[model samples]
Target: MSGGVDSAVAAARAVEAGHEVVGVHLALSRMPGTLRTGSRGCCTVEDSMDAQRAANIMGIPYYVWDFSERFKLDVVDDFIAEYAAGRTPNPCMRCNEKIKFAALLEKAMALGFDAVCTGHYASILTDVDGNKQLHRAAAWAKDQSYVLGVLTADQINHSMFPLGATPTKAEVRKEAAERGFSVANKPDSYDICFIPDGDTKGWLGERVAPVTGDILDREGNTLGQHDGAVAFTVGQRKGLSIGTPAADGKPRFVLEVRPISNTVVVGPKEALAIKEIAGNKYTWAGLAPEHPEVEFACHVQIRAHADPVPAVAQVVSTTAVTGIDGTVELRIIPAEPLNGVAPGQTAVVYVGTRVLGQCTIDRTVSAVPVSTPEMIASASPVPVNA
Candidate 1:
């Protein structure tokens, strides 16, 4: 249980179903805050206490598992690395992939548990062949399948989501209240759980060490400068502080961040449109799609709450790598251009309500191209260190 209304109600339902339920609250941090900052943080000491109280009411076994070290390595450190590489990553996606499903599920199975149930707003359905497939929850507004896209076939087999069929979050809250759960009215946590204050830039600044970098346009002309390339992300416009406006007198959006060159590239908003994205790291949710080499129709969602867009995808083999036969990548071509997509972002593929698979974007083909190659070659990087 997460010490939240949804999880408490989920535990209640699991118990009512006549199965032995054990509530395990993960101690993701060694030093957790005793009080919640009004839903700004989670996995705190307060959350663990709340979870234990709910478990007491349910008359089930409950324990706080110390997964702090693993969480730090898999989720927190990976987040910093991705940012330092100038790529925006979803820590929630990493948490679900590495911690909740991979690590926690491993421990549960070893302890003779049949499944690891949670309050995630997603569903697991068994097909005719008894293969488990991940699907979207009934509550569209609260759907969390995008984050759970990292689940593989094996993980989905041993996962349960009691809140999947609920029509709304209000229903979960009502059920919690009816069950006398103290967390019924508790505010839901938001933003990065580890960074409770929601100042991601400041938190990353301390680790990445911001350095003054040149901000350039597509034509390789210096437009402005920024304190740190890590602080900026693709499509950001508000804080560029580029004193010189575009020649067209239009606002520019961040097109790319080059950590190696310590450069931030800004361009017209249209330059943000991407026609295609491809990633070498890809996994199927249950079964691999048919005709791996041919294009298949699907919908691609880049963010948790973003609407899925109609697209076509295919698996292709790239240059050979050592040991491996050849590097393979999943490429998606959206019917309409995707705006502001960046490397390290997860793309969840869906066929109707069923999640087909996902990929970590490694590269993107821009819908708009630079005017000339000469300009790009001519633009020299201004190194902050030098």
Candidate 2:
């Protein structure tokens, strides 16, 4: 249980179903606060106590697992690494992929548990052949399948979401109250839990060792300077502090952050439109497409709450030589252009409400043409099948 209404209610339902339920609260931080400051952070000492009280009410076993070291290595370190590489990453995605499903599930199975159930707003469906598939929850507004897109076929088989069929979060909260859960009215946590203060830029600045960098425009002309290229992300319009106005008298947005060059690129907002996105690292949620080599119609979602876009996607081989087979890549082309798409963002593919698969964006193709030869050579579109 997460010391929240949803998880407490989920545990209650699991117990009512006549199965032996055990409430496990993960200690993600090595050093956690005795009490949470409102709903700003989670996984603290108070959260564990709340979870234990709920478990007692349900008459189930409760245990606090110390996954602090593993969490630091997987989620926290990965966040730092991604930012250092100038790529925006979702830490929640990593937590679900590595901690909940991988480490926790692995230990559960070893301890004779059938599955690892959670309060995630997603569902698991079994096909005719008994193959498991991941689907969005009935509550569209509370759907969290995008974050669970990292789950593979094996992981989905051993996962359960009791709160999936609920029509709304209010229902979960009501159920928790009826079950005498102390956290029934407890507020939900938000933002990056690890960053208690919620100041991401300041948190990263300490570890990344911010270096002074140049801010350039499309023509490679210096517009201004930044304290650190790592602090900026694609499509960011604030804090540029550029004194010189654009020639067209329009606002400029961050087009790219080149960490290797310690440079930030700014351009007109229109230039942020991206036509194509491709990624080398990808995994199927359940089953691979019948003809992955050919383009297939689907919807692609980059953010947790963002609406999925109509798109066509395909998987193509990247053979190094004539007869030598190499890695493959998942290429997606949206029917309409996507604005501010960037590398390292996870793009989840969906066929209606069912999650097909997901890929980490490695590169993107700009819809606007390059202004100069130097620009074209630097940001040219790479063939997906090459």
Candidate 3:
């Protein structure tokens, strides 16, 4: 249990359904200024107490399991590494994959639990063929189907999301209160729980030493100095100290972040408009769809908060490269131009509310250059002294 009202209510629902229930809280790590004490978030000493309180209210047992090392290796390390490679990573997805379902679920099964349950706002149903399928929750706004889409069929069969049919967050809280749980008024947690302050860059900088680099324009002209190439991301407008203004006096946008050369490329706002994105490491909720020669229409979401945009997806084959591992790429062309489509972010494909699949964006392809070839040929190359 996550020590939240939702999970508490979920446990109550299971009890109301006449199922034997036991609460398990993962002890991720110790918080500062607390001796074996839990914080308000999951895995903290405080959270364990909260879970125990909920369990007691339902007359059930609760225990805390330490999974700090696994959390660091699986979730935290990958988060930092993805950012270092100029890609935005989703830690929630990793946590759901490694911690919640894989690690905790296994432990729960070993302890004699028939199935694991959580407060996730998604549902799992068996089709006519007895195959499990994940569906969106009744609370559309709070539905977490996107992150939970990474679950395998095996994991889905053994998991339960009791809040899947719940109408709203308020309803869960009301249930918790009516059941006499103490955590009914507790606020819902947001962002990465481990990084309590939500300073992703700060947390990454402390773990991985960022390398200082040069900021350059499209024509390879040295514009300014950046603290580190990893610090800048595509479409970032702040912190760039480019003195010169654009031809129309508009602010410059980060077009690319090159980790190989440790360079941040800046250009006009128009350069940020990308028509297509190529991605790798494809993960689908079910069987991979047939790779059609023509682009297949689908809804693509480049970022978590981004509204799913209508797009056509096609499979692109790639030759063996030196370090790149994937042999095939997923190409997505949005119905209209999209801005700030950064590499390293996920492109989650959806058929209505059901997530079809997801892949990591490798690069964005812009249209033809606005500047003339003769004008670019006349400019001298600016050297970036490493």
By summed lDDT, the worst window of 10 consecutive residues in model 3 runs over 377-386
**Local distance difference test, each candidate:** 0.86, 0.87, 0.75
Q: Residue-wise lDDT of candidate 1 within 1-386, one digit each (tens)?
A: 88888888888999999889999999998764657788798998899999999999999999999999999999999999989888888999999999999999999999999898999999999889888899999988999999999899899989999999999998888888888889988998999999989999999988888889899888878988899888998989999999987889999998888777989888899988989887777888988776778889999999998999999999876443212445677889999999989888999999999999998876776888888542111112111110
Order of all candidates by TM-score, from best down to worst?
2, 1, 3
Q: Which stretches of candidate 1 lie over 4 Å from their true place?
A: 320-325, 373-386
Question: Model 3 off-target regions past 4 Å?
Answer: 31-42, 290-295, 320-326, 367-386
Better of 1 and 3 by TM-score: 1
lDDT of 1: 0.86
Candidate 3: C-alpha RMSD to true structure equals 6.0
lDDT of 2 at 32: 42
- Candidate 2 lDDT tens digits, 1-386: 87888888888888988888999999999764657888988888998999999999988999999999999999999999988888888899999999999999999999999999999999998889888999999988999999999999899999989999999998888888888888989999998999988999999999999899899998889989999888898999999998999998999999888877888888999988988887767888998888888999999999998889999999876453112356677889999998888788899999999999998787777788776742211122233432
State the RMSD for candidate 2: 3.1
Query: Is 1 or 3 the stronger prediction by lDDT?
Result: 1
TM-score to true structure, per model: 0.94, 0.94, 0.87
